[model samples]
Target: MPGFPRRLTSRAAAGLALLPALTILLVAHLGSTSWTIWISLTSSRMLPNSNFVGLRQYETLLNNDRWLVSAQNLAVFGTLMVVGSLLVGLLLAIAIDQRLRVENTLRSIFLYPFSMSFVVTGLAWQWMLNPTHGIQKLVRGWGFETFQFDWIVRQETVIYTLVFAGIWHAAGLVMAIMLAGLRGIDEEIWKASRVDGIPAWRTYVSIVIPMLGASFATAGILLSASVVRLYDLAVAMTNGGPGLASEVPAKFVMDHLFERGNLGLAAAAATSMLVTVVSIAAPLLYARSRARTAETRR
Candidate 1:
């Protein structure tokens, strides 16, 4: 009976400790979501209005070119960012997992970018990618006379610059995740593969990679969320410049909300982004849940 009381006390204390976090999530997330939905239905502009405009905001949001461009940009940017980051990160992880001579130093160098703020990363890249004073200039000064790598200032290529930065920043994070996954893998499998005269690459492609399904999922989901909420990086790097070339959903919503003073439209844009992200993420989340359940049963 005395031990039971102690256990109860510990449980109670743990619940109390979590109370604040739960409260914040409920109030901040749920409450804001409700408010956004309500605003989207109204004719709010410059300030909140309860004009009850029905689906007028949604209609306008769907029809707007800026929103459409933002959506398209998101597709390209999100895809490239996720895929490139995964590939680079996986490669880095594999390389480091090889028990290199400078393991710790190399790992820290790779991971250094992930620890920096996106704004900082974007700003740094922006300078480096600038034509007159950055990469191009540096290259030209080295006697090439016409070496140009100014993707940041080009309408057709500005979004790709974002992708480049996104991959560079996120690859380290993916590497960390993959490294953990690789490390957890049973060494016996590697020995067995080698004994069977299987190539290392083939072993990774067929066996080890499949085992790291969870790592891939985690990296993808993380990158997906970052892609959706990709405001700070765009702001710092390109400011959605080159005539709406690198515009993304988050930036579109923010521009409408603050600059254009169209609260209802902004809410609609925000809600649309939320729906798109949920549509993409729900299946992934469900699959991951099912896999976890199967793992537990096994």
Candidate 2:
């Protein structure tokens, strides 16, 4: 009973210390999200007038062809970007783990692109992919006039260029992550596999990859957020063109909120995107939390 007051006092002190953060969470995050939701429910335009109109903005947003196209582009882009980055990163990580002579140089070369901002990545790729002034011109000058590598200006294939640039920028970070995970793996496991005469590639595919679940999850979540929040890249590269070919949800929301001067519709689009991300992420986070708890208990 004598320890109860001390424990109580400690808990109280901890709570008091966290009060500022709690207040910020309530006001900054919840309050802002609530306001955005309310805006979506209204007939807001350039000005945030409070004329309530339930679900109308969302209906209009769903019907809009640009929004639909943007959503479609996001699905394709996100899938390819995630898969491509993960594969490229994992391969780089494995190569580095092989004790290459120039490991540091190779790692830096791969990672250099990730240190750049999306704006820079997009602009650089835009120049490199330019049909007349870039790769195509350079190649043709070198005696290959029939060679065709221009996809950025073509509406049907512009999105793939975005995916290529995105994966290029992102793969290095994923490689770093996967390499860290690979390092943590017990050397004993490798020795055991060697003792069993298992082939290296088969071991990596069958056992090592399964063990890197945490790294994979981390990279996946990071890439997912980038996919949802993608704006700068699209803006810099195509400006959502070759006629909305590379448009994404974040760009769609920005266009309506500012350029289109329709806050209600923008809010609706924003809320939908937010909800989609949260829905996908929440379950994974919860499962991770439960796994951690179970491991602790064990």
Candidate 1 structure quality by residue, lDDT tens digits, 97-127: 9999999998999999999999999999999
In TM-score terms, candidate 2 sits at 0.93
| Residues 1-298, model 2: lDDT tens digits | 9999999999999999999999999999999899999999999999898999999999998999999999999999999999999999999999999989999999999999999999999999999999889899999999998989989999999999999999999999999999999999999999999999999999999999999999999999999889888999999999999988889899999998889899999999999998888898889889999999999999
Clashing pairs in 1: none
- Prediction RMSDs, each to the true structure: 1.8, 2.3
Q: How close is candidate 1 to the true structure, as a TM-score?
A: 0.94
Q: Looking at model 1, which ten-residue stretch has the lowest summed lDDT?
A: 276-285
lDDT of 1 at 298: 100
- The residue ranges of model 1 lying beyond 4 angstroms of the native Cα positions read 1-15
